[model samples]
Target: MKTAGGSDAAKRRAGERAAEDVADGFVVGLGTGSTTAYAIRALGRAVDDGLEIRGVPTSFQSRQLALEVGIELTDLDAVDGLDLAIDGADQVVDDADAAAHGALIKGGGAAHAREKLVDAAADRFVVVADPSKLTTRLERSVPVAVLPDAHTVVADRIRDLGGEPTLRDAGEKDGPVVTDNGNLVLDCAFGSIDDPDELATRLSAIPGVVEHGLFVGMADATYVGTDDGVETRHY
Candidate 1:
C-alpha cells in the first residue's frame, strides 16, 4: 500500500533538506519509503559531484533505488559506525518533552525491522516527512513483523495488550505480504497511544515479534516539508 502522507512536493523538500547534513566521508543508512527516496537521489547527485560516501540500505527497495541513483552500497556488517540515517515516518507525534519529541509510527512499507536496525546504529537519525505526518498524538496503526508460524500467537498476545491485530495482505498478490526477512506483518490498532515507550517495550518482549513500528527516542530530529519550505525540529 502507498504510504499516507503529504504531497509529493512537500515530501521531496523535506527529504532533500535532510540530505544536506550528509558529509563527504560519511557512511549513511538509507531508509525505505517515498520520502527517503528523495534523500537517496539527492545524495546520489552529491556523489556524482565527488562526495565520498557509502550507504547501508534498510530494505531491498532502498538498495535498488540507491544503485539506480549511483549511490555505492555497503552491508551493515562492514560498517563500523554509520554517520547518519535519513528516514521517513508514517506518523510523528509533536511532543514538548525532548525525549518524546519525535516519537514515530513507521512500517507503513513493512520494513520497520531493517529500518530500526540501521537507524538505531547511526550516530544521528533524521526523519523526513510532509506536514501531514505531524500530529498532536500518535493514533496510527503500529506494524509488527512476526515469524510466519507465530503470527496467530502474536496476534493473541497483541489482543491481550488491548490491540486489534490484522494480518497485512498483498493487494495485487494472492497471499500475505512477505517481508525481506520472510516474515508476516500484523498491523495493530490501539486507538491513541498514551505511552509509546511502554508500548514499544511490551511489543519487543513478544516472543515472535521481529520488530515493532513504535520508534520511541530513535529520531534525533525531523525535517517537515511544507508547501513553501522545510521546517526542522530537533528532538
Candidate 2:
C-alpha cells in the first residue's frame, strides 16, 4: 500500500495511531483536520473490526464522520474524564515529534474550543503527525479560533501584537465558515513566537473567545510517523 503523502499524509499517520489506541474501548476524543480525518476513517474501521469505543467529535464534521464510521457517540456535557484523546497538530518536532515544549496551532477547522475541551477532559492526549508537520519551534503557524461575530475586533488585537492576522477560510465558497461551535477561525501569521505558553494564556483571557488554538500542558505524549518509521515522545 502507498503511504500517505502531501497534505493528506499527516491524517493518514494520525489515523493509524488513533486506530491502535481506540481498540481498547473507552471514551475517545476526536479532532478536526485532514490528518484527523484519517483517524476518523480508522475509527470506523476499528468499529467494523469489533473495536468498542464511544467518541466525542470535536466538530460537527467529525461527528458526522464518526457516525458514518460506526463509532458510538456521546454528548460532551454528559461525559466526565475520557480514557484517551488522539489528536493531530498543525506542527510537531522534527526530531522527536513531541507535543511538549512544542507550540501547537489548531482550530483551522474552527473546532478549537471543542478540541481543547475534549483534550482537557482526557487523562492522556496523544497527538499523531507526520514528520513534515514537525518543527524545531512552535507558534509559526498560529491558528486562532474566534467567535464569528467578533472576528474583526479580535483580528485587530492580533495586529496589535505586530503580526498579520487573516481570517481562516473554511475551505468553502458559500456562507460564513461555521465551526462546530459556530465560530470562525483566524490564521495568524505572527512569525516566530518566543513565548507560546504566555500567548496561549493571553489569548484565552480575551472575551468572546471560546478558546484559542494553543494546547499547552494538555498533551501528554506524541506519536510522529515519518518516512523512516514512527517516533514516540512522552511529555
Best by TM-score: 1
Residue 79 accuracy (lDDT) in model 2: 78
Model 1, 8-89: lDDT tens digits are 8899999999999999999999999999999999999999999999999999999999999899899999989899999999
State the local distance difference test value for candidate 2: 0.73
Point out where model 2 deviates above 4 Å.
1-11, 93-100, 174-176
**lDDT for residue 98 in candidate 2, whole number 0-100:** 40
What is each predicted model's overall lDDT from 0 to 1?
A: 0.93, 0.73
Clashes of each: 0, 2
Which parts of model 1 are misplaced by more than 4 Å?
1-4, 97-99
| Candidate 2 lDDT, 42-151, residue by residue in tens | 87887888888889888778888889888899977887778888787776544354434645666656677888888889888888776766667675657776777788
Best by lDDT: 1
